[model samples]
Target: MHDFDLHAPEGANKKKRIIGRGQGSGRGTTAGKGNKGQQSRSGGKTYLGFEGGQMPLYRRLAHRGFSNYPFKKTVQVVNLVEIEKRYENGETVEPGTLLVKGLVKGANPVKILGDGDLTKKLSFKLVAVSASAKEKIEKVGGTVVSNETVGND
Candidate 1:
């Protein structure tokens, strides 16, 4: 049988040596900080972005381009292939409908590009469509409600 009471493992649960107490602690005098300097003093923390009193990396790098226009249109894109696969013949596709189907998100305008063939005659109201997409939709006897029409109405 093992003697559990007599042999409590050596150095188990040893207390941490508290520094800066007195000479008895051995780590007293300089509190283990080693002779005085900038680091030995209190509140010696340096700013993270400090580059040893040199110019920061951000300032040194050259900024090349400038955007003068503040309000540039940022549009969400949907491909014609995705539309062809998702919608049925004679279906009315709109932004809200697309959102409901989890195809697009956010407040950005949606632009549809012609990437695949469409067999179904779908009537879609979109923010923008490629010239090929418009042609394809018209060729298939489908109605494409353009951004201009939407703006007019």
Candidate 2:
């Protein structure tokens, strides 16, 4: 019903246009590609960012901007809801412990986020912990012994 929407009416078979089938279909000899040329031939595909034998837009534009992406470190994150489900009260939560629980694997930097309620008095030894998460953990008699130097955050 919208101007830009493409919706076929009910009972409309909507067969695809069979190009180069026959002349009766109005796509006969040329098939809308015109006479002999590179595009007219079968399997003649063009690579992306290609121009008509001219300099591409990417080449014409100035190479500007700097990215610190390569130097940036990726952080592994976990939520309070999941932590409560995995560990029991008075349990220690470290990166190695998280690996065993399938919460975080490898030596990737881990961060604890506070998004839900937690009642366990667990001990935290993580790379990073949000301010709210630390407050919540402390509120529940949990200890946050974080080493922020290990993570990018």
Candidate 3:
């Protein structure tokens, strides 16, 4: 009972190294894929973005992110006759006085949209105030100041 479970046990089913059939059988001639390049012939494939030619791993990697229009938030518009041709009825149009009067370009969040006309009773301390610009700024008696008591909202 030794030879472990006897019979074909020690090197089970021998004889499958039968390559290209010739060079006296030791994995025959180039059947072990060596010499004469391109992996020794016969359907040898390697060329559609191949890497053995050095520069290919998607051309050796270096191009990423955004192929256009996935992130769109460039909303910066103000009206109500451009805040009564620039504040002065109670002056308080915040976002640091609309970036010291050049009206917008970073304070990052200022929405105010109502599109034209208002006789000035101005006072917004703003950060997002539309509904026809808070109904034309409370129909021209103006007084917005409510961004939930300015908790950086």
Candidate 4:
């Protein structure tokens, strides 16, 4: 027996208080805009960064620092643990193969770090390999091809 009929009566909703109507509307004349000056006139809206004639905030903040090294290399790193889990035994792994397998992306250099055990022998061409990773690979009868030397010439 709950009443869901709660609503404003017919025509009970007050009409929105309109501005800039005309002098006859009472809200006309200045259209409730008040007496002269910047705000009372038409097209008085200001820009977002404006501070009512004061210096803006953006210009007050400190700006510093410079970096001359523009061609710095950003190498994407992969650990041996991840490689061991994703790769198959006796498979040759390379940057292109890793990219095709969705293990790595882009032309960014790949660095392999030793973090887990390698039970399978894998021949890999990588940009960088840790000493431990290189040793482990060689111990497991795998080959490590360095990309840095290949890219230099």
Q: Per model, how many backbone clashes are there?
A: 0, 0, 0, 1
Order of the predicted models by TM-score, top scorer first: 4, 1, 2, 3
User: How accurate locally, in lDDT, is each candidate?
Assistant: 0.80, 0.85, 0.74, 0.80
Could you tell me every candidate's TM-score relative to the true structure? 0.64, 0.60, 0.29, 0.67
Identify the superior model by TM-score, candidate 1 or candidate 3: 1
26: Cα error in model 2, Å:
28
Any runs in candidate 1 off by more than 4 Å, and if so which? 1-9, 13-29, 55-72, 148-153
- 2 or 3: which has the higher lDDT? 2
How many times do residue backbones clash in model 2? 0
Clashing pairs in 3: none
Worst 10 residues of 3 by lDDT: 144-153
Error of 2 at 36 (Å): 13
Give the root-mean-square deviation of each candidate in angstroms: 5.5, 12.3, 12.4, 6.4
Among these predictions, the greatest lDDT belongs to 2
The numbered model that scores best in TM-score is 4
lDDT of 2 by residue, 20-82 (tens): 878899889899998998889999878899998799999999998999989998878898999
- The better-scoring model by lDDT among 1 and 4 is 4
Clashing pairs for predicted structure model 4, backbone only = 28-31
lDDT of 3: 0.74
Model 3 spans > 4 angstroms off: 1-22, 32-35, 41-107, 114-123, 126-135, 138-140, 144-153
